[model samples]
Target: MKKRLRDLGEDALIARLLRGFPGGENLRVGPGDDCAVVDPGRGLLRLLKTDAIVEGVHFLPDTPAAKVGWKAVARVLSDFAAMGGVPEHLLVTVAVDPAKPVAWMDGLYRGIRKCLATHGGVLAGGETSRLPSGAMISVAGEGRVERKHLILRSGGKPGDLVVVTGRLGGSIRGKHLTFTPRLNEAAWLVRNLRPSAMMDLSDGLAKDLPRLAEASGCGFEFGEVPATRGCTRAQALGDGEDYELLFTVSPRRWIAAAGQWPKDFPQLSIIGRLCPPGQGASLAGGWDHFSP
Candidate 1:
């Protein structure tokens, strides 16, 4: 039997697809990261990321077009935040059935502009194509981070303390549409706490934490899973779509970092700690694109 995407799962399929892709010296970080980091021959590092939202998968048919647009752009911005970068420019590709109304498109543009205004970036340009079935919106983004402050998922140490911003899970209860990307918090972290590794929690802690541990060549032991009010711990671990920041800081600095968390954002939590590989408990289940 031939192997399909469902057989390999999203991460494995991605690995198989990009197995032989070449990387240049300028490529600071490529696939398997929140965003691609590139040396643009300047003082700063360039960050590149692309993300998409589909009609049925990401949103229902009756979901607000404006929310969909915001999510498409915000998703890319979240990746930039994971890298401790700033979004600069964006290009969007929109595909929808020919019958989609001009008003809907206008609403989407409004949401896009609003997200950029709230976050940081501009809609440089984009392309539009007709779709025979449902709608899909893709956003490509460029961002910048100072060389000294760039964060990657592979930088965690075995003893680092893991932290997360904001409560997790319960996104399906409408938080997904309005969740804020932790850009400002990330900036503060790099400036002060200086986390060793960082990534946004899009695929839930269950799926994403393991990726970080594997990348950093470590394992993780859970402390307390922080779920949103009314959500169970299981939901906090496995219910994807929580666009919060999950990061690791040196154990020595974890205390000061926790003490100095800004008052504006009140949901910082110490969720876990990294351990030596093969010494931690298991975690499984999250939103998988190809899983039955």
Candidate 2:
């Protein structure tokens, strides 16, 4: 019998299996964070992000193979949505044990095709190999936005209102696997409000917001954080994988445009404000895979 992933340990498994993957070329920043960044140059900034789902790390071994496939694609799409970019294509790579049926691969591909079709994205190309040990799926998404429209974590200014689209937390209940990518909402926002800074809440506001603040060279203050249906204040602030857009906008426009937002996405709400240089991030806690 083969040793389980748990027996090998997460760090050991990553170092052994993933450390040898190729690197360089357009990869501005690679794995080791919430998402990887690939710069396409200075004109139409092409953002590339990839995510993976393993049999044990992301889902139960018995989880539906189709849903597993969908989740894999959704993860990367959500990153593009957060960056306010339109997904144009995807590259999918899969590693499967010899024992898995070919039908399972078919089902996974079907799920990926369904999601790409729904989002108006095309399947590019990818690599496949026999894992001979466990199952793994990786997806690389390519998206683009006008250089001026590309939002980054480093654009907030003092007095700017911090806003969030949709509620947060308790994603594991069901939202994790079924949530829709906020691509439409993000595009609309970029075209209309022109957020000063923006990013998705993947590692929870606690960990992510501070990073944004650091990038923008500012601090933040949250007076009222909007909560999901059954989410507590703590959960709303610290539960990772919310996939909602967190942004900052000038106070004047934020207040003026609040009422004008689309009715379909009424959940958009001002939760805080960018503070002066010394204030720093108030909410400072979230999920860290290797943290004890």
Candidate 3:
């Protein structure tokens, strides 16, 4: 009997699909982290990712096109932020009905432009196509990280402090469309105190936390979770698309990093601590695409 995709779950499905591909010599990172990394021998590693948003799937049709476009660019930029990298160039490929209103397309590009300009990147160029149903916008983002400064989700170890940038939960209530990526903070953290591991919290903590733990060969334990206003503790744990930064550091380094946390940057909090596998860890209730 043929097995349905639901049987494997997202993470397993991804791993199964990626198992046979051969990683090239210069490929420093592959399909696992926020971005794929390539070494060009320039003392820097290039960050690459392609992300797309479907109209009805990612946003309501009634939502503003500008916000839709902004989300498209921001999503990719957030991945760069996760890896302690800086975006340099963006390529936008959009699919829309040929008859789509002119104003709608204009607004979308306007939003995309603002994000690129704000984040020190340029919209070099891209291709456009006509699609049958809802519009689709894809962004190919390129960034760079100092070879030594690049952070991965697999470097965490036992006894590290699990920290988060900004509050969690309630992203579906407009936060997902507007929350800024913590690029500045990620850069500062990686430069000053090397984190054991890090990643942007696009999925809820409940789901993403296990990902970090599994990648790092560790587990985690936590007390109070920082829930956002109008959000329940469960939502804080399960609601996806927070886009905040989740990272780990040695407890000793965290003390120094905390003391020097930038006053102007987003608030940082120690939400948990890492431990040996099967220790105090919670991995329940998160978005699963194939859940029935």
Q: For each predicted model, how many residue pairs clash, with residues at least 3 apart or on different chains?
A: 0, 0, 0
Deviation from native of the Cα of residue 51 in model 2, angstroms: 2.0
Every model: Cα RMSD to truth: 1.0, 5.1, 1.4
Instruction: Give the residue spans of candidate 2 off by over 4 A.
Output: 1-43
lDDT of 3: 0.87
For TM-score, the strongest prediction is 1
Tens-place lDDT digits, model 3, residues 198-225: 9998779999988998899998898777
The segments of candidate 3 whose C-alpha lies over 4 angstroms from its true place after superposition are: none
Q: Residue 85's C-alpha lDDT in candidate 1? A: 94
Candidates 1 and 2, the one with greater TM-score: 1
Clash count, predicted structure 2: 0
Q: How well does each candidate superpose onto the true structure, as a TM-score?
A: 0.98, 0.84, 0.96
| Model 2 poorest 10 in a row by lDDT | 28-37
Per-residue CA lDDT of candidate 1, range 1-292, in tens? 9977788898888988898899999998999999999998889999999999999998888888888888888889999999999999999999999898888899898889899999989889999999998899999989999999999999999989888988888898887887788899899989999999999999999999999999999999996888899999989999989999999999788876667768897477888899999998789998899998
lDDT of 2 by residue, 81-197 (tens): 777788888999999887888888887888888888787678899989899777899998778767666777778998888898888888878777767788888888888888998
Which pairs of residues collide in candidate 3?
none
CA lDDT of each prediction against the hidden true structure: 0.91, 0.79, 0.87
